[model samples]
Target chain A: MSTFYFIAFLSIFFSILVISAKNPVHSILYLILTFFTFTIHYILLNAQFLAIVNFIVYMGAILVLFLYTLMLINLNKESEPVKPFMVKIAGVFGGGILAVALASSLKLVAASNPVILKNPDLGLVKNLGKVLFNEFLLPFEVSSVLLLSAMVGAVLLATKDPKTA
Target chain B: MESLTNTIHAVPLNHYILLSAIIFSIGVVGVLIRRNAIVIFMSVELMLNAVNLLLTAFSVYRGDASGQVFVFFIMALAAAEVAVGLAIIVMIYRNTNSIDINVLNRLKW
Candidate 1:
């Protein structure tokens, strides 16, 4: 129980660093730490499959890709755009108000029935695979299409076009 | 495992909701305050993750695997989004030599 609190604090703290870091490389490294904490949270929840996937996909693939791009562009500190101070304050105020509103409204609702983990093994890969293939077959297939489209779009967008340039 | 249910019982569901809510709000503030395009993309990922965490919590609480399955799809979606989004950012950089959102406002070089 206390482990959860400590990990949650680490997650929040690292994510804060992700956005607050001055250098993009430092931000990416912090983001990796943030995702690592999330992986731990998944383990704490007994979602074994999700934890591994999050570790591989998020920390391994996605964030590494981010780091790669940050290197490719080599955005120097001078190149980093700095918004006005007033805009930043407005952003924080707006986000705080949003959080307050959501918290207050959620508090108004009757307390939800306590959670009970009925199936301890429900988060295992086997059960999740069964549920995925059996009930969510179409969506699963559609997601492949989505991936393919995204791939093609990314390639097309990334390739240099002699005609346009 | 008895430990599974025990851990879920350890942390109340409300705490999960509030934690995710705060994370999501931080994502929002990141989007609003940051001028860099890539940071904005990272912020969006943060928001998606908060939702994924909440979904997993609900799935565990209800003993339902479907929510986890749905999270897998969201992960896929996020991957695809990052691919396309970073590609767009790269292109923006190639042409404008800058990946700042404010620079793209005019929509014309």
Candidate 2:
């Protein structure tokens, strides 16, 4: 119980740092820490397969890609463009409205009783694989196409066109 | 090994919902306030993850693996998004030498 609270606190704390940090590199590092806490959360939920995948995919692959992008862009001499004061206030107000609405709606509804894990091994890779292959075969296959298209699109977008200039 | 689910049972689903709500709002605010394209992109990732957490929580409590499966798909989608997004950001930098949202407003002009 205390461990869950502590880890959740760490997740929120690191995520706050991820957003508030001025340096992009610092933000990415903190985001990595935040995702690490989430991995712990998955473990707490007994989702071992998802936990490992989140750790590798988020911390290992995606964030390193972010770091690479930062390295590609020369951020030294160029100054960051700051939003106007009014725009900042508007943004805060809009998000505040959303949060308030969600909170109030939550308060109005009676929460159902939380259930214990009836099958402790439900989250294991074995069961998840059974469920995935049996029920979600199409989406699973389609995701590969999504990956291929995304890869091709990224390569195409990043490369300079020979005919343009 | 002792099962952590017993410990997690001490925490309520409402608490997870609230925590995810907070995280999601923070992501929203980050997206709204930040001008850097990469930070905005990171904030979007943060939002996706908050939903992911909520889905996993529900998955565990209900003894259903479907939610976790969906979470996996979302992660795959996010990876693809970041790949294409960062590539576009790099292209933006090459073309305009700036990754600022304000500068990106006039897309066709």
Best by lDDT: 2
Q: Which stretches of candidate 2 lie over 4 Å from their true place?
A: none
Tens digits of lDDT, candidate 1, A1-165: 778889899988988888887777888888888889899889889899999999999998999889898888878746587899999999999999998988888788888665567777888999999999999999999999999999999999999998977
Which parts of model 1 have CA positions greater than 4 angstroms off? A112-114, B1-5
Calculate model 2's interface RMSD in Å.
Answer: 1.2
> Each candidate: what lDDT?
0.89, 0.89
Q: Please write out the lDDT profile of model 2 over residues A63-113, one tens digit for every residue.
A: 999999998898877767788899889988898888788777788878756
List iRMS (one decimal) for every candidate: 1.3, 1.2
Q: What RMSD does each model have against the real structure?
A: 1.7, 1.5
TM-score of each: 0.95, 0.96
Query: Looking at model 2 chain A, which ten-residue stretch has the lowest summed lDDT?
Result: A109-118
